[model samples]
Target: MGLWDDLKMQYRMGGITQRLIFWNIGVFLVSLIFYEFRLGTFIFPDWLALSSDPLVLAIHPWTLLTYAFLHSGFLHLLFNMLVLNYAGMLFLTFFKEKQLVGLYILSAIFSGIIFCGAYFLMGRVSIIVGASAAIMAILVAATTYSPHMPIRLLLIGRVQLWHMTAVILIIDLMQLMIENTGGHISHLAGAFFGFTYIKLLQTGTDLSKIVTGTVDGVLRMFKPSQPKPFKKVHRNYNTQPRSTTASKTAVKDKKQQQIDEILDKISRSGYDSLTQQEKDFLFNAGK
Candidate 1:
């Protein structure tokens, strides 16, 4: 009904990818407003932007993550967000929302660490900004998960996943010698995380679980505790409904069987072959 109400609804229903984009854009706009009002750039960005100096990073460890949501310029923000939207949609097609969040955060952190290391070696202190590292992770993660998947590139027609990755790698590699060497290195670091994330997953290990658990633990700390309701002092002898272990086993077996069947279908006909209901079932099971 209203702007705030519409935003709440969108946040409630929108996928994690869209929410991440919104957050980045919101921060970028706020930064711009502050700049426009002669607030000067030194105040906000200096606190949040990732720095190559180990001393600065040690003092403000949170900058490793905060920098991913900041941008130095409008074009910088636009390019990164565009890539994020594109890659995020592709990544979400086959992975859970939690996985996306984990990969993004982890990759950005890895990138920041590597960037800091590079600059430290060069004996220089440079503040890094932008979401390029995180966006690279999303793009590479999707490409790793489904290397054969087709994507339409302008003037290039339909191209395979590896092709896109190769081109990106080449561009990043080339740019390393030209300018922003740390940024290019960070992109490569993020790409490494994306590739490894899928490889480890294929071996039945999920890094997302760790990220999810940590998030839940922190959320619990901030969440207000609800008061307990009054309970009856007297006990009744009425029997409760019986839920047999056998029935529970049967239910679990059925769900697993369905999941197996859906996965088999995907392997044979690709992810697009599944019906809407089947897709939702698989997605929920992932959660």
Candidate 2:
């Protein structure tokens, strides 16, 4: 399959990360068309974009989550989606697919609530849109889980994930008073969630469990029930065929399992700690 077909298959397979990326992009394109026609950011209805005003939100509470999907401009949308895709992949290195989706949703709502509280405290009203808070949450949460993991960068050769997380978070803190107070407030809130989520997880509490159960419940509701047909219980292990397809699938599954184990090792220690054989496996897999 081509790149497009592969993406379609991924979407159909319901990978949470890819689905979020596609949803953001889809929303961005529609917003862009409306933006051109409506003359400005007003293209997005107030109902879809969150407001710092408590009164406005009281009337349209759903904006807390929906606002995250709308972006102010193309560059804003592009940067957010890029970061989300990168951080999200890194996040999945040690976490389940459901956790990422839950983090994004919970972070957005947390950020919105923080933004509203700040507005109320400061007696200000403003509009807010973007996925920065949720993206920040994913980036920070992944770093917290694998703080020592070394990530290669373009200009900066290699840096620990914790180092990057600290710098970005400090920047967000320092910018809180500069402008866009609500946005900065939201960012901080999301960061707090990310940090605490990891801390709580270390204590044996998985905050995403509730969200995961909800997702499973929804899926079960949609899944068609299988009928129970008559079955013969006679065992005949020697009569089973050794199919090539089944063997190939088993080989593929083994390779994937090996890859996952190597990734988990790298997450616990730095990439440099990887064995030569492990490094070669990653190298070949990348190819």
Candidate 3:
């Protein structure tokens, strides 16, 4: 296969957040290539980029959404992508694909709003760019989902998930007293949305639903669906499946045996001794 095809295949295998990282990186590279060709000015149109100018923003309100995908430098993109990768994987472990997508778009929009609002309040006339705010949102969401999960830091032994979250929040809070106070404020806003979103989800209410509905509406507008004809099915014979008491007892006995074996292993080696596969199996069995 050609190089482009190979890259596309690899991207297809990546998770939702990974796909987003690829898109952002692709945009950056394309911009660089255009710059080399002396066409960099067209990379991300000024109209599309977020601006603090009231006149420009009023003319193009969509900048709030587009700005989240534009990064200023390589290191900036790298940091954001790293955070996104880590948090997105954790989110995927519990959320369905649809929910993951919804969360991402909602997080991005919320982050954009925070960034723009902070910029205006800080009296800065510069445009806001980068995925940091959205990345922060994902990190906060993951922390909220499993606060007790273990996380190993370099040169710092394993720490509880909440501890890492506390450290991050503290750092962001501290940054508010520095030159990039606006960015820090945006991060805080994203983090708040993340935490609140997860809490609401647990209680069966998702704010992301509004974003999801909007996306569905747009998709349907582009690709209208046609109703399909339905056919009825008729069953020929009525027969009851037979149940054997001996077979039922045997099945129950086998399950009990498996449970006993797992309990014995846990008793002898401790829960941490079990592999992830084993732990998952035990968890599912208990469920």
Give the TM-score of each candidate: 0.74, 0.74, 0.71
Best by TM-score: 1
Model 2, 1-287: lDDT tens digits are: 34564445446443567689899989877776555334444456677889888778999999999989988877778889889888998899899888888889888999999988888888888889999999999999999888999998889889988888898888888988997778888888998898888889899998888777888999999999999989879866665467976897899999999989987876576455766677667666755
Q: Tell me the tens digit of each residue's lDDT in model 1 across 156-255.
A: 9999988988899999999996998888999999999888889999999988787898999999999999999998698777564456756878899999
Task: Give the Å error, residue 261, model 2.
Answer: 18
Using alpha carbons, what is the TM-score of model 3?
0.71
The residue-by-residue lDDT of candidate 3 on 133-242, one tens digit each, is 77777778888999898988889999988898889999999879776675777678878888988999999998777878888889999996788979889886735444
Ten contiguous residues with the weakest lDDT in model 2: 33-42
Question: Where in model 1 is the C-alpha error above 4 Å?
Answer: 2-4, 33-44, 224-287
Off by over 4 Å in 2: 1-7, 10-15, 32-43, 221-287
Instruction: Quote model 1's TM-score.
Output: 0.74
Q: Which residue pairs collide, candidate 2?
A: none
lDDT of 1: 0.83
lDDT of each: 0.83, 0.83, 0.73
Q: Which pairs clash in model 3?
A: none
